[model samples]
Target chain A: MKAKIHIMLKNGVLDPQGKAVGHALASLGFDGVNEVRQGKYIEIDLAETDRAKAGGVVDRMCKTLLANTVIENYVIEFE
Target chain B: MKAKIHIMLKNGVLDPQGKAVGHALASLGFDGVNEVRQGKYIEIDLAETDRAKAGGVVDRMCKTLLANTVIENYVIEFE
Candidate 1:
C-alpha cells in the first residue's frame, strides 16, 4: 500500500521560517500574500497488501515517526 | 482567495529527519514502515479576488518564499 501523510503546525504557533519566506516573496514582487504557514508531508511505501491494516499502520506511523505531537498534527491518506 | 503551496524535498535527497522518525517508530513497535520522505506545505490567505492573479501570486510565492529551489520543489493550489 502507498500512503501520504500531511503534517502541519498547529494553530497559534509561531512560524519563523514561514514568515521569512513571506517577506522574501514580497521582495520578489508577489503581492497580497497575507500569510504563510509551513508544514510537512510524508510519503510512505508499505509492503503490506491489506487496506484495513494500512490505516492502523499509517496511524501508528503518524503517532510514532511522522509527527512531533507537541507542535504538529497529521492526517493520512491511502493512494 | 485561499492558496495551498506544497513544497517537498526533491527525490534522491537524503531526509535524515524522516529517517530518525522512522527509527523511532520501529522502536515504538510500528511494523512495515518501508521508507519515509518528508516535505512541506504552505497555506496562504490572499485578499485578492482574481483567480488568475492568485496563481501568479502563488507561483511567485513558491519561487521566492515557499521553496528553496536548491533543495526543494513546490506546487500551488487554489482553495
Candidate 2:
C-alpha cells in the first residue's frame, strides 16, 4: 500500500515561508494572488496489504513523527 | 478561486530529508515501511473566477517562481 500525507500549518499559525513565496510571486508580476500557504506532501510505501492496517499504521506515524499536532494538521490517503 | 500545487522531486533524485524520515520511523519502532518521499503542497487564493484562466495563471506561477523545473515537477489543481 502507498499512503499519501498532506501536512499543513493550522489556521492562525504564522507561516513566514509561505509569506515569502507570496511576495516572490507578486514581485514576479503575477497579480491577484491573495494568499499562499505551504505545506508538506509525503508518500510512504508500506508492506502492509490490508487497507485498515495500513491506515492505522500511517496514522500512528503521523501522530508520532510526521506532523506537529499543535501547529499543523495532516490528512492521509491510501492507494 | 483557489489553486493547490504539489511540487515534488523528480524520481532518481537523492532525498536526504526523506531518508532521514524513514530512518526515524524505523527507530520509533514503526515497521513495514519500504520507502518515503517528501514534497511540497501549496495553496493559493486567486481573484480570477474563470477556471481556465486560473489554471493558466497558476501554471505560469509554477514555472516562473514556484518550482525548480530542472529537479522538481509540479502539479496544479484548481478549486
Q: List each model's interface RMSD.
A: 1.8, 0.6
DockQ of each: 0.73, 0.93
lDDT of 2 by residue, B1-79 (tens): 9999999999999988889999999999998999999999999999999999899999999998889999999999888
- Tens-digit lDDT track for model 1 on A1-79? 8888888888888888778777877788776778877777778878887888988878876776567899988888888
lDDT of 2 by residue, A1-79 (tens): 8999999999999999899999999998898999999999999999999999899999999999999999999999988
Instruction: Please compute the TM-score of chain B alone for each predicted structure, in the order given.
Output: 0.91, 0.96
Model 2 reaches what TM-score against the true structure?
0.97
Kindly report which residue stretches of model 1 are placed more than 4 angstroms away from their true locations once superposed.
none
Pairs that clash in candidate 1: none
Tens-place lDDT digits, model 1, residues B1-68: 88887777888888887787677767887768788777777788888889998787678666755678
Provide fnat values for all models in the order shown: 0.97, 0.95
